[model samples]
Target: MSQVSLVAARIAALQQAGSALALLQATQELASCADASAAPVLVEVLGFNNPGAAVAAVKGLISLGPAAVEALLQLDPVNYGARAWAVRALAGIGDVRGLELLLDALGSDVAASVRRAAAKGLGQLQLDELPPDQKQDVQGQCLGALLAATSDGEWVVRYAVAVGLELLAAGLPAGSPERQQAQQGLLTLQEAADGTPPVVQRRAKLALSRLELQ
Candidate 1:
């Protein structure tokens, strides 16, 4: 059968699945197809209560890359679970189109997991693909968000902030102001004595060490 026909059949099977196991199997099959045409259906699967199916859909969307951005952006804002999954997919894809969403999620989302994903996504964004001026601007914005997230109450989120700062700094030119700022952010995390978790402190120390080597 043609690829389109097969994708359609897989989508039909996913939609018709009556049991959780069946849904996961169908979702996995559709996701493995990696057809851009399946993006919308894959996105819809994010809203399902099935974590396995959602994970498969996220992988499928990541494979679709920029083509999946629109559908991910169109997800219902009220569906926090779906939007969280979309954030992960967007982060994995690293498309610049999801920049604003990632920024917002990192800065304000109530879920630590979502915030952590967004922090990492901001660092992982494909800024090198943009013109020099635009890349600088976006990088600055990403740096600002990540630095601000360093104070997150959750140790896990703060750990992610350390990672994000390191990655963002690696993309910046050495001796640049943004790079300095990222390094300072890492130092603050590493030196914090206000009950910072040992893991977070170690992560920041490790990130700072890596940045020094770059």
Candidate 2:
């Protein structure tokens, strides 16, 4: 069998293990594998009460990338807190399927941590790695979302937005409109710096300093 098949087999056994610790170990091992087949299993584990296993499972799903994104969308966690974790996981993957969810979470009544994760997740997308045709559309969507997020109620969410803008801008050239828009967003943050929390001010300032040099 191929490498992914072997990993699939190992993960199957680990999934059926009698203990959370054993499942945790399996998740750690899965994180190192590039198999997309493991995504659904990892998605289920995100709700596991064992923090370590849940975290490891999330990381593993992220490593699985777009394939894992498919599995994440099909999830409907009965536990409200599990839904938060699912949102956070979707954000981390930064897949297009998760984009709308992140955008909504940014403006929702959900936990601040979930909103913050959404901002960070958009920043983590590998847009530059996509094909030329797809990259443009994705960039536009991500930029619009990030720009809108600058007005979020929580300073933490705004801080993540600023950081995410910096990351998105980093992959573009100075003359590019997207890059310019990101810089403009940072300027908005700067103008409102005094009203924002200290942590957000620091992040906006740092992002501005970096953009100034870009």
Candidate 3:
């Protein structure tokens, strides 16, 4: 078989294996792929018709760590869900450079789910246990991204953004600038509560509680 055909066969077998665990392992092997020719095929596995396969593939790609970031991001925009998963997986690896890709994803993605995943990943990355100097700028940028998404035309996007902010704000000090900014953002959200959907209102309220309790 030609190298391309061989790689495709492996990917097909991995999909046929069907378990999340098996697919996860296949993703790992795919990530180790040395042939640039196989890269796109690896990404396609991430979009298996099966959600389990897709999730496993994403987990595997992420396990590749920083090395996989650029390739994952370069996938077609039609595959935004896969790309969003890649952003989360990158964050899981504790790499902040992925933050830029996350921000860009939020800004340009029309899909609420993808944007939300990026937002959530950004928040988790904030609590990465990095040193203050390293975490500060990214945290600020995360807050900004969440804020921008809060006003997104879609309720799902707004709710996701609020949830991201709340997760990132957890346990911040009463007098901290972060807490203050969160409170301000909540106030802005509250002012628009009448128009906000039930889900988003719930998220906004949760964020408010976290900030005020601080």
Q: All candidates' lDDT scores?
A: 0.92, 0.78, 0.67
Ranking according to TM-score, highest score first? 1, 2, 3
Q: What is the lDDT of candidate 1?
A: 0.92
For each of the candidates, give the backbone clash count.
0, 0, 0
Q: Tens-digit lDDT track for model 2 on 156-203?
A: 888889888888888777888888898888888867555677777678
TM-score of 2: 0.80
lDDT of candidate 1 over 111-204, digit per residue (tens)? 9999999988898898777999999999999999998888889989998898888888999999998999999999999996697888988999
Pick by TM-score: 1 or 2, better one: 1
Candidate 1 lDDT for residue 177? 89
Q: Which regions of candidate 1 fall more than 4 Å away from where they truly are? A: none
Q: Show the lowest summed lDDT stretch of 10 residues, model 2.
A: 77-86
lDDT for position 81 in model 3: 57
**Candidate that scores best on lDDT:** 1
User: 160, model 3: CA deviation in Å?
Assistant: 1.1
lDDT of 2 at 2: 88
